[model samples]
Target: YTEDEGFVYLNSIMDLYSRKIIAWTLSKTLEVEEVLKCLETAKRRRKTVNPVVIQSDRGVHYTSQKYKELTKGMIRSYSRKGNPWDNACIESYHAVIKREWLNRFRIKNYYQAYQLVFEYLEGFYNTVRIHSHCEYLSPDSYEKKYILEQTN
Candidate 1:
């Protein structure tokens, strides 16, 4: 989500437990719809039955009334101003994604960036890449293990 000619805004939601990118969207504008889509996608993908708390930066979209309504059932939290530590998990993930993957490619347009991001998230990052925080398991694997453990 750079301001370059070919880049677009990337709104993403991460799960701290598995260090996974649960949901995301790439758009030409930083409209509230972008983050809302990400939030809804995360809930659906996770099959979230209970209220979940979300921690975000003090961005305009996060503070908007529409967003508050959309997340009405859930507890919304904000990171402290000028404190990256308050949102360290997601901030670190963003840095990792840029350094380990996105920086290697030369994106030609927003469409290409979107496709590339989708592939990286779905095909590689979620399924293949192991994370140290998740006991050296990939995010999907970590979640699967939890399910298996519960069923056993």
Candidate 2:
């Protein structure tokens, strides 16, 4: 939450295969609509005919009818109640981003927070930062290698 914005929520979708953040939306509300927007963005960015399993915490937004409707063709998995470890990857991502980047800034408003998030996600995390889960390559590089291997 930003100082002036009251409560800013970040809804993100991660592709577990490469640990890439496929899409994200920073919104002022925690409404299911925001989550829907994030999902839509992910769908637009990553075009795939194969169905994928989407895992999330049992948040009200994820459990909503609208969310279910939009994700009709995909499998949905929810974390056991009170067990955050069930969705550890995304939980860790939220922790890492705050500890390494967001914690360092005095975000006064929503726009500032949005800018910081964009820089960390697009400029660094996806393109430059190495992850052991990705075999020490950045998410983008790791994904490229995987695609290249599939074609070859």
Instruction: Please report, in order, the local distance difference test score of every candidate based on alpha carbons.
Output: 0.86, 0.92
| lDDT (10s digit) by residue, model 1, range 22-93 | 999988988998999888898888777777889999999999998998788889999888987879888787
Error of 1 at 151 (Å): 0.4
lDDT of 2 by residue, 1-152 (tens): 78877778888899998999999999988889999999999989988999889999888999999999989999999999788887999888989899989999889999999999999999988899899999999999999999899999
Candidate achieving the largest TM-score: 2
**Candidate 2 overall lDDT versus native:** 0.92
- Model 2 compared with the native: what TM-score? 0.97
RMSD per model, one decimal: 1.8, 0.9
Candidate 2, residue 55: the lDDT equals 96
Residue 27 in model 2: shift from native, Å? 0.8
Which pairs clash (backbone N, Cα, C closer than 3 Å) in model 1? none
Of candidate 2, the 10-residue stretch with the lowest lDDT total is 1-10
TM-score of each: 0.92, 0.97
